[model samples]
Target: MRAADEQDYLDFATARVGALYRSASLLTTGDPHLAEDLVQETLGRMYVHWRHVSVADNPAAYAHTVLVRVFLSHRRRRSSAEQPTGALPEGVATEEDATLRLTLLDALARLGPRDRAVLVLRYWEDRSVEETARALRSSAGAVRTQSSRALGRLRSILGDSLPDLTRS
Candidate 1:
């Protein structure tokens, strides 16, 4: 790559890495280690495709799409079957409102990978149905259906305690 192109890629990665990590964290159900790995893989892939990706209309969105796809691919691995634990692992920092965050993340961890992906992309990232569909390589109709179903499942998983947890 030319010096200018390499510089652009570096700048782009620096600007977007934090956002990518945040989305990856959500996708991994707050697993920081896995989230870091996902972001690294996503960035590595983006680096490889920077020449093509740099001219895209929204490179940040492209990065996010890559992060989600990397997450889904990771989930599909046979060795990825191990479930995350309910408690945040030791040394992980928590926000001031840790209980509420933990409750929500724990609920998210219970969901299937695709459902989690839909919810994260549709709501957390605030992507439109079409945008999320493109990211997931799914149809818009499927995205809508999955979004509805996933929200319902999240509600079911949270039950009435969501209100109580948030009230604290």
Candidate 2:
């Protein structure tokens, strides 16, 4: 690749790495190690396609899509069977209640990979149904259906504790 292209890719990666890592963390249900791995894999893939990606109308969106796809692909691997523990891991700080966050992440961890992906993309990433559909390589109708079902499952998993957990 040309120097200018390499520089552009470096700039883009530097700008977007934090956001990508955040998204990957959510997708991995707060597993920082796996999240870091996912973000690295996403950036590596993006670097390979940076020439085309940098010129896309929405490069950030493309990066997000790549992150989600990489996450889903990782989930499909045979070694993806390990589950997160109920308690949240230490060292990550947030203003939000840690109990609430841990509760939510625990619920998310119980979900199937596609269901978790749908919820994360639709609500966490705040993407449109069509955008999420494109990212997941599914129809908008499927996205909507999966989102609805996933949310219901989350609610079921959380049970009545959700309201209490969210209470300030």
TM-scores of the candidates in the order shown: 0.88, 0.89
Question: Candidate 1, residue 82: CA error in Å?
Answer: 3.9
Q: Specify the poorest-scoring 10-residue window by lDDT in model 2.
A: 82-91
Stretches of candidate 1 off by over 4 Å are 85-96, 163-168
* Cα lDDT for residue 163, candidate 1: 58
Q: What number of clashing residue pairs does each candidate have, in the order they appear?
A: 0, 0
Clashes of 1: 0
Q: Please write out the lDDT profile of model 2 over residues 69-122, one tens digit for every residue.
A: 888888878474857544355575664667777888888888888888888889
Candidate 2 wrongly placed segments (more than 4 Å): 85-96, 163-168
Cα displacement (Å) at residue 115, model 2:
0.7
The CA lDDT of each predicted structure is 0.86, 0.85
Local distance difference test, candidate 2: 0.85
- Model 2: colliding residue pairs: none
Candidate 1: tens digits of C-alpha lDDT, residues 72-121: 88888846575755536334455645766787888888888899999999
Model 1 lDDT-worst window of ten: 85-94
Cα TM-score of candidate 1: 0.88
